[model samples]
Target: MPSDVDSTADEQSNGYWFRRGLAGIISAPAFILMASFVGFGGLAREAGWSAGEAAFITGFIWALPSQVVFIGSVAAGASFGAIIIAVALSAVRLLPMTVALMPILRDPKRPGWVYYPASHFIAITAWVVSMMRLPDVPRGGRLAFFLGFGMSLTVCNVAVTLLSHQLAGTVSPVIAAALVFLTPMYFLVALWSAARMRADYLALITGLVLGPVFHHVDPEFDILWAGILGGTLAFGLHKIMERWS
Candidate 1:
């Protein structure tokens, strides 16, 4: 029922947002992500993976932790089944991120199936940036913007991984290792900056304080328990404060 002019305007709006999203690669988070992947590429090469293999993993898994787990497991001679389990467990953390972002990116008029592919790109970098930026975008074009941003990051990082794999020895091992920490450091800062609720602050701080303790207690399951306990404590405190107020 819309006129041609109206349809054209809508297209233009979508294109504009998409371009803006693609431009996100020039931002700090994007740079940090790519730098971290340079570390990953070096690690992959050290682990004896081919450039093609490293690029494939980056393009498909698209999750640094999982990719690292895969490379480490292979290098350690882990069984195929064990490697699969390790990678899947490492990636479990992304589920909450994807769940939180779905409502913001979902468009009522679009079919739900479209989001499945979109969800594949929901790494910490994409999720954090989208959560911070998508609220300002028009609801109709949020998906377009996210797709542009997410897809561009994936493509760019994969290329970086491949090139880094080829040029692995050029970077010192210690420096490459330090670079790998940048993504998580950036994630923490970005999460803190984007948090709007007291509960959010509580969860982050509690997680930060407890993470080391849990790591000492059980290095294998530290992240899982720290997240669970931190989140539970934060929620309880928030509820109690609400009641008292």
Candidate 2:
């Protein structure tokens, strides 16, 4: 009986490490890079941006929605103010990520230099998953783990962007479209996985319903407004639902 318990505990520990290793393999930086090739870089080429410049932006920005808006709006000859607003709206979610993560990821004794930039790679997917999983990890290891994971993502994005730029001509448009679509598809899947609260569920459903409707009216503002409006409405409705339930 004692041996059986010991064996089971060892297996569980090994399994935990293995899973964490796998999770580190799929970093937000990597996903952001993958999205860039099919989505933004291709569009950038189409819009006359030099491949090097687009790839540079991809490596630096690592924010897909904002990059998309910046590229798309610029392509359409939008004004500086319009482009700024579009990018700003898309990037608003970054604030929430930083707020939620700082308390957990920041080490009390560590200097700001190391932690400040680790905070930069804390995107929606990374932040959400880390929030869910990092608490279970030993406090000292969380930052190290996320650093490795986030850096892997950043490096992969640059590599993949160059590869995508070179290979874009070889692939069919359909495949390219699917590759671009994967980022959002993954996001929805992540959102679904993280939906423990009623407000999150309602927000997702409402946002999906509103996305198309708002798009038809104004393509530029659709995603931004839909998320804001739908999320707000979802929050309100969730409160009512809870009170009445």
Candidate 3:
């Protein structure tokens, strides 16, 4: 068991290093989204929000869809509470992701102060790939590996965001669309590769089918309900399949 664990840790550490480099390359498209934000921010400048406020939302919110929703909804005369709720609902997907990741990326021996800053590096795309690769890593080194990998991605994201703001006009819309697509494309591929077990496969299918269906019914609650109800259903399905076999 100990030997197996050690091997797994080595694999995970190596995997993280490999993926971290790939992530940097794949994440180049995200620069286009950054450019889009700068353009939008420029437009918003005259509407009411100051440049700092625009930059803050772009930087601190960090979630593109939610940031767009918040800014657009407010611009359209939505109440503050509604805007907040919209953003919160959009980000609710992070909760399960965080739960699923904590064990894999956590160092039980380390204090909270370390993980506190480390958690900032966690993002949807990175979390998905990291989770997929983590099982091969040993528990002891997984957290440190993630810290290095995630920090790399974060630095790239920030640098791109700042660059986009400074050179928004230089980026074409086609390139921006491509960049925005990179995150999801990477995630979809990683999620597909990670579905090695029945439960995970069912969860993926359930989430995919339910995401759009629930979105049409109620955009705000779709992710939460899909993750909860679909996940539960998938779990039950997996158990039944196992029993039958």
TM-score of each: 0.71, 0.72, 0.54
Local error of candidate 2 at residue 4 (angstroms): 29
Best by lDDT: 1
Separately for all candidates shown, the number of backbone clashes (residues 3 or more apart, or on different chains) is 0, 1, 2
lDDT of 2 at 87: 86
- Relative to the true structure, candidate 3 reaches a TM of 0.54
Rank the candidate models, highest lDDT first. Answer: 1, 2, 3
What is candidate 3's lDDT per residue for 54-133, written digit by digit as tens?
56665566665566557656765656776676677667766777888887776555676777666765655567667766
Clashes by residue pair, model 1: none
Candidate 3 clashes between residue pairs 3 or more apart in a chain or in different chains = 9-138, 29-179
lDDT of 2 at 94: 83
Q: Find the 10 residues in a row with the least total lDDT in model 2.
A: 1-10
Regarding lDDT, does 2 or 3 come out ahead? Answer: 2
> Model 2 segments beyond 4 Å from truth?
1-23, 26-48, 136-138
Q: Rank the candidates by TM-score, best first.
A: 2, 1, 3
